[model samples]
Target: MPSVRRALISVSDKTGLIELAQGLTALNIPILATSGTARFLASQGIPFTEVSEYTGFPEILQGRVKTLHPYLHGGILAPRDAESEAELRKYGIAPIDLVVVNLYPFVETIAHPEVSLAEAIEQIDIGGVALLRAAAKNFASVTVLTDPADYAMVLQQLQDRGEVGEETRLRLAQKAFAYTAFYDIHIASYLHSQHAPGTFPDPLLLAFSQMQSLRYGENPHQRAALYRSPLPPAPAIVNARQLHGKELSFNNIFDLDAARALLQEFPERPTAVVIKHTNPCGVAQGETLCAAYCRARDTDPMSAFGGIVGVNRPVDLETAQEMGAMFLEAILAPDFTPEALHLLRKKRNLRLLTLPLEQQPTTSPWELRHISGGVLLQESDGPGVDPSSWRVVSARQPTAAEMEALLFAWKVVKHVKSNAIVLAHAGQTIGIGAGQMSRVDAVQIACMKAVLPTAGAVMASDAFFPFRDSIDRAAEAGVRAVIQPGGSRRDAEVIEAADAHGMAMVFTGRRHFKH
Candidate 1:
């Protein structure tokens, strides 16, 4: 146990301050506080010496320089060794045995969309951070606390054992450092985002807050947690409300993201997407949610077993009743009607997420993937394909109706994994082949899985066919038109194959390769 003879306390959020101060006073320890905290303590009838009085130096710069004096830092940072004691005696500075400091609300300040840079910078909290660092570095003689929630535990320990233990002190010191580190990260991220929006700096700083601990990762042996951006709430899966569900597993969240990404692409009409293993299995658009969901579900009901579903429109009773007939792992939509909610709630373990359909994620944010020794950072994949940029590469031009189906398949293929192929007719997917090692294999699998006639249907590929074999296979399956990003080694041969089959093909300059 370590004795706390003198305690310094200063906090912007003063929850439970009076009780902690009372506990410390009962233990016969004096209190030191800053001007604002001192005023608060005085109003509560808890006596405390002002930090200025203890330092013998008046605060300047409109209180920005408060508690930054050497007398304060020296008291907190000095070691308990003989040399430190001698130096403290020479300076007539007493050692501070405890420090309670929480940084100003920089995260909360920037959450306001209208907040200015000056206001956010003002909340960076220089003196409070310095005080916390000094106290934490000398934990051998001091107890540091950054969260008011810990006050009750520390108060109980002080009353029962007469002092805080070394173990508790060590934990508190670690927490204090983490608090300041996250605060500085938020400040740096905000300033950079304001000045250099999309440019990556030499040393990138990421600000994240842990939302919850997951049950496990993809495997039982691995542990994982979910973290989200420190910025204000946006239209995101992270900000979605889980209305009814068992806790989301890592796999469930991944598939939900895939489904929602496709749902955003066709928000003008009711859209439905079914995803499995982070790859879209089926997709469709209709005037009603029930019609869209049934068409999407009918594409590959076998593959959609226990899959995640995303819809761009509110779910009514008819849609909910149709969805309830399937064994789905989760459903995400903008809203659910009362009848829909009541019917769906019967499936107690179903995961239902609600996110508004109107909020488009137009701004690209930093995306990261963890490696063994380092991390890889990249911007999100580019925006929707421009219709004017697509060129007719085959001799036979795609009919107006074929163009509509081709574009619809093109949008759906972007959400599938690499080496992906989608077959669509009438704005709904007929079959999909994803995550194949070869493009020809994906084409074959997609044609094999089609329950409806492939004749007059359109085909979309994530990337161009490397050889003419994929185009030959698509033509044999009666694919009337093809859409792909044309940059293959044998582009002329592939176009010749399409022309030989009297098929129309369009080339998008950009490729959407989702790993």
Candidate 2:
């Protein structure tokens, strides 16, 4: 490839601009920069020619039309063939060997709570995108850069070999294309969301940045990587910081996310939950973190082994000591005390992740699932639980204690798989049955899985029971109260069965089916 003879620079993010320009100038490469970049370079004592001076036309439209001229695009898009060379000379265009540009902060501008649509529209970049696409298209002869971190590497290569290699140029071109696509996707999504708030667009566009390549996928033979959404960072597993432990596996990430989702249900209280294979084995809330963890684990100690643990509050020394007794795969929390960290660090292979404590957990507007042919999207279940919407269906009303346990079980059952049933006493779950084929089978499994006594335990079902068999089974297991989304065609039969068994039942009128 030919050495870089001239470069064009127009960027909204000016990080490392001066240093890159100086390096290029040191190598005897002339630079043509737009007015903003030229002003910055001139102030920093770096020499560069302004774009208007080279194009022989003043910038119009408040600097928006600065780099959209043919003189600039022609230079960047020209190939290294005789025909292209003749056309370049015919138009008095000097070939541009490098293009460095970063788009305006459209994402950042829209992130503000009170930003107007006109303000966001003004930040949607046109000239920068055009320049990047033109240079990236001619990667055989041009090197395009959209990231500041690449400046040093490109500069080093030029200093060593006096020219950028084809491989590096190709990679940079790919990155530039991705950068522009990401920018455009965000702009389109924002505009569509504003125009039609609760409806899906005809052609959906999603953009994600790869966070890491996992050692393997759910299985050893499959390949996998983790990607983060393009939206602003939030307190989620994707944005969590790993303080100690070996690299996380794909299963560990999945279990940790399940634990985090459950923990989000009880943000105001000190809670701990144990998860196994994306299902909650035990969940409990207590006045203290250690007590909560112990109670949660004690609910089903057999299933708690090698499980992922999530805590709503910071881990203290007491909780860490209690956790150290178990062979846990990972733990996710907001923060950890120094003493707690010191104790937990002894388990070298245990993954410890921390999220931002100041921000509450947030749910995405949509839930997406992938199928064989395409994808499915729907509204998120929620971050809210309103017991006031429930109606007492059975003749007997639940006591305050039973009501509390019923609500606790209801929250936990939402996170469980389909055909889910949870048995709870006090504020801790005593037995859980998830992903069963039948509701009666789930009830029986909950009874059999109980480590604590099931007598007086309240039960929660993710959906209505189609028949009275589930109610009979739960009553046989000593359940005193039940909460479910009551929508079955045989609702009268189910309610009569509950009344006959002396069980207090509440209908939420909302089903939570997780498949």
Candidate 3:
């Protein structure tokens, strides 16, 4: 087959546009591009025909209708076969062999702290989808590039063979299809969140754009990458810039996200969470931000070593002084005082990030898991537990001090990996058991690790106990009270066990399983 002769170039992220355009021009391919892209090409001394000249129509609607013309679509979608070529010639259409296109600045535009509704709506692209689909549909004969990361490989293939091969073309086509699908999912999610619901509903649409391929996962053999949720522009996992330290692994990213999400929940309050292996090692709230950090650090001093710490309030000098005494992998806060930043900056290996706390938290609609062959999806179990409606089911109602500890444990337990158990006394964690196969096992592990079993400790379970056996175990370990979502059929047996042991138990009517 003859080499691709015509290429269209358009992009918002112009990372490798010049290099790619140069390579295409070197191969004698005629480049056609939009107004800004065409001007850029001209400035760079790369030859290109304006898209309007090729399509015989000016860009209208303030550039919204630039690439939406049938001439552009017909060229990209036209097959290279004799009949398709004859038909295109009959209709005055030229075959477009390659499409290098990226959508508008939707992600950046919506990420602003106070973006208006009309401004957000305007960021969504129309012609970009048409260009992607047209090129992707004719993948057998055309190459479509949507990501800047693919530029190097595509240029290498074109350099070696004067054109991208069929295999490379197919791979690019697959990427284009997935890219467009994710983009549409994001638009659907945004519209649903902003508009009235119809009879046919897309209740949940969660899409992530991969930020980077990591060195490996938790284990070096497993592959992983940091991914950000589409288009909303929260200072989420994907957007976190690593200021220092080594490359982030899968476990690090997981733990960081758990800590960050919990911090977002209490932006107006002074709160700190120390997370290890995607579970809360310690979590505390206090009057001052420094006090909160100190309390959280004291909760599990040993476990906090090399763990991620997240703060809801600004990090002050006092907090930084305390943090500098120990080692940490990462620290995230809404902001940091100048003195605090100066002190913390001395620890060059620590990754520090400051995020603008959102006025209202964006809730995820569904949870997803990728199996070997497919993916599993379900609704998100986001903060379903109501604190005010909880009932004291045990014979002995919890004292005020015990109630405070229980509430603290309740929030910490929800973010821990299941099957999870947390033991707290006063305002700190005494012991924690995480990622066990059984609930009873989790209880035993936590109790075994406790510094003082009889220290007026309260227990928090991530989910309802399937049997009263776990409650019995907690009672034997001198647990004063238990907090758990009471949804199991045998909840009566569990409550009776607590009562028999003269322990206070609260049923939250909600379960937090963090697997």
Candidate 3: which pairs clash? none
Tens digits of per-residue lDDT for model 2 on 1-515? 87899999999899999889999999999999998899999999999999999999999988778899899999999888899999999989999999999999999899886999999999999999999999999999999999999999999999999999999999999999999999999999999989998898778888899999999999999999999885633567888899999899999999998887788788777899999999999999999999999999999999999999999899999999999998999999999999999999999999999976446756787888999998999998976799999999999999999999999999999999999999999999999999999999999999999999999999999999999999999888899999999999999999999999999999999999999
The best candidate in terms of TM-score: 2
lDDT of each: 0.88, 0.93, 0.82
TM-score of each: 0.94, 0.98, 0.75
Q: Any runs in candidate 2 off by more than 4 Å, and if so which?
A: none
Per-residue alpha-carbon lDDT of model 1 for 1-515, expressed as tens digits?
56787899989999989999998988889999999999999999998899999888988998899998878888899988899989998998888989999888999889887999899888889999999999999887899989999999988988898788898999999998888988988888788889988888658776677899999998889999998876633457887899998999888888887777787778578889989898877899887889999999888889988999999888999999999998899999999999999999999999989988657655346667899987889887743668999999999999999999999999999888888999999989988988899999999999998877888899999999989898888888889999999998899999999999999999998898888
Residue lDDT tens for model 3, 1-515:
43687999888778989889998888888999999899888999999999999888999988888998878898998778899889999999888988999987766766675888799888888898789988988888899999888988988877787778888888899999888888777667656756753323445556777778989888988988877665543655666665555667788778787887776655556888898877777777788877888778777788888889988777899889988899998887777888888888888778787665544556555567888986778776654346799999988999999998898788778777899999987766778889999999999988887755445799999899999999888888889999998889998888889888899999888878876
Candidate 2 TM-score, C-alpha based: 0.98
Query: Candidate 3 versus the native: TM-score?
Result: 0.75
Q: What ranking emerges by TM-score with the best candidate at the front?
A: 2, 1, 3
Runs in model 3 with CA error above 4 Å?
Answer: 1-128, 136-175, 187-206, 232-235, 264-269, 287-290, 336-348, 356-360, 436-441, 452-454, 465-478, 487-502
lDDT for 142 (candidate 2): 98
> lDDT score of model 1?
0.88
Q: Cα RMSDs of all predictions? A: 2.2, 1.3, 5.0
Residue 250: error of model 1 in Å?
1.3
